[model samples]
Target: MTTTGTIRSATGYLRSWVEAQAAHRRVPGVQVAIRSGDELVLSAAVGVADATTGAPLSTGHLFRIASHSKTFTATAVLRLVEAGHMRLDDPIGQFVPELEDGGSPIARVTVRELLGHQSGVIRDGQDGDFWQLGRPFPDRSGVVAEVLRAGAVHRRNEHFKYSNVGYALLGLAIESVTGSTYAEHLQASVLEPLGLTRTGAEYDPARAEEYAAGHTGLLLGEDTRQTIEHVDTRAMAAATGFWSTAEDLTAYGAAHYLGDERLLSDDSKRIMQRLESIVTAYGTEVGRYGVGMALQTVGERQLVGHSGGYPGHITLTLIDPVDRLVVSVLTNAMDGPAEDLAVGLVKVIDVALTPRTEVPPPPAGAPPLASFTGRFASLWGVLDVAELGGRLVLIRPTLTDPLPGVEELEVVDASTLRVAAQPSFGPAGELVPVQRDADGRVVSLRFGGVTSRPVDEFRRLRSGMTHLA
Candidate 1:
């Protein structure tokens, strides 16, 4: 687990990096939150909540955290199982008897299979255009009708096949057995217990303005993104219809850690996090799925969390149980880089938590580390000189994963640094001259004999340069 002191030491740089990445990636807005143990180490927002109106995004704004609802529904079902209200082996058709008619194969699909996405249920029926908002999301009768109408797509337990409809059936089963709506049960059993005041099982129209407006992606020949309206998911709420902020989402994730009895028993959490299916891409194991949970391994550390995609928002939350660390990234753009941003945070934190003994101490009379730290812009791209764990390193903030190609620095003097080490093909042994204005603020620098300047100065210089004759 990343200790509290280690996380706090990196949060200052992390915030600035997130701000730069959001602007460079052209994401309209992003919300980020981090939790270590019981403390919220960071809650930050960058860019505009509504690009059309230029409203600055804030941590208070909510995002339609679609698909994260599966975690909540899964928790509710497990709680019921613990209370002796239901069994994992029970066929789902017993609670929602509508599918038993016509001797459908879906009648034999067990609750465990649905939870693990092994039921082979259809992805979303023949016309899942509801995702595109062409029609209203299905209600109870519509959910039942879709199952009866389409039946099963493949044999049960054949392989992992994600189906939003399968979760919708679980919602119905929760209602039938508990005699309460899914929202009510979830609120009482999970949200309220976790004290996630900013989260909800569905979109609440009363707080409409508090919700970040979803936007169209940069694709589809559109020059700019247009806002999309939030509509209730109706019966599909269990699968993809929850709203939350990065802070509350991380708070919810913290409860899933083992031994945090506020949510599930450690044994149940182990069951929920066990590898039930391996998601493959081109014969490579890309990801793993547990009972309604997504499990990942990042840099020898285990992680469990989920990613959400709604009409205009893309979000992800990762929990490191061993380190007791959690990170959530929420974006109000259809093509938001939530996954990249979330993982980037983890990588940087890992770098911060690493022992500094491997990094050499500065030479005598070396200048303050902050003096040379800034963003330097060249005609080709941008590079950031940052002080992490009291060591100066050059980072390229434009790439999807920004930590690769990082170069360590050994200060030669107040205005010079030598690239001490880096990966192959990098300028591992180059002297960089730092330039400063009269106020001692960094204004320019040179890497590998290539001149770079501050962003504004570089733009001005480019605009005034004469074209080749």
Candidate 2:
């Protein structure tokens, strides 16, 4: 539906925006690809794969996709569901014997809840030692043991709280059902059939030079320092540990948009795209937990996508099934503005998806200043707002201590304000846009996949509040 001229303009703008943002953030490498229907619309790379080695990134350069790998894991499970090997409502105890008598009634945890992130299991591998140091990640038994020891966060099917541990258990279920490892099952069922040569769960040591090195910005505290940490997370193999490229990601997105015999049926794909949860009170957007994919509406149109963040990488892949358009973005730096870039790319594609007619250019300046101060909560985290010196200050309840200081807010409209916080020892500032309802009430705020809105009572509050003003 997008006109040729508008599509060209959008592609050019996306390339320019991504390049500039990557450079400003000191992100060494990035790969982006856009697809419409089964046709590849655009595929490009920017910056260097290795900042130290000076290798220019290409569409072939693989980066750790982190939790985006969850899609693959979920796909493998769905394959079993389709083959009658397992049921979506099957209990975890049916597969893993260790979890059967764990004394926590693990049998009550269904496979669907695990995939939907409603199993109420504790989030795995978040301890300080897991990320900071090269701590050995737990295996299938180890992760299950940890969950049993820690216990569930809430009753089963109570609410939507993301749990890596739940997916990890699903991975175990995959192995038990297929009589093979999670990696092997995925390769056979999803990757190989899809012709994704550059995607896999295991990181090949021989191809280490081919993979992009992950980087992190310097810590901004009493001392300012830069650090490059390599993510060696084999323990998260089934949860958040897969490496992929833009080319492979685009192909996968296309398969989802265009169903294949080796993968899901059209009916199954439609079921996957249905919203399982109404994340907001307005119900304008529904987060449907299909087999392994999340379906949500952007405006009146439905979009299917997922985002992932690790210590050294941030990745987002979104597909608009209506127009059969897919946008995939990957960055080497963890804290980079990958989410914003993804959103911007999607907007460009949407503009291109239909004819564009402009009568006149709007005013060049921003809207009048308006303070965005309120409390927003969701399943993941909470955002508390305060007005200071004509600016909006926000603090995350999980982090202790007030924000460094007040930050400037740019009013986008009467109901939206974009808050810009100073770079955390990087060249790029953290940009968060907060949206309010017509009543001037904070309805929702999004920073990556972490969205907090009213009516979400399962809030994880931390004693130490860190202000990023």
CA lDDT of every candidate: 0.88, 0.66
- Clash total of candidate 1: 1
Report the lDDT of model 2 for residue 328: 87
Each prediction's RMSD over C-alphas, in Å, is: 1.9, 14.4
Off by over 4 Å in 1: 355-357, 464-469
Q: Total backbone clashes of model 2?
A: 10
Candidate 2, run of 10 with poorest lDDT: 354-363
Q: Provide TM-scores for the models.
A: 0.96, 0.71
Q: Which stretches of candidate 2 lie over 4 Å from their true place?
A: 1-10, 125-128, 221-232, 258-261, 280-291, 355-357, 360-469
How far does residue 110 in candidate 1 sit from its true spot (Å)? 1.2
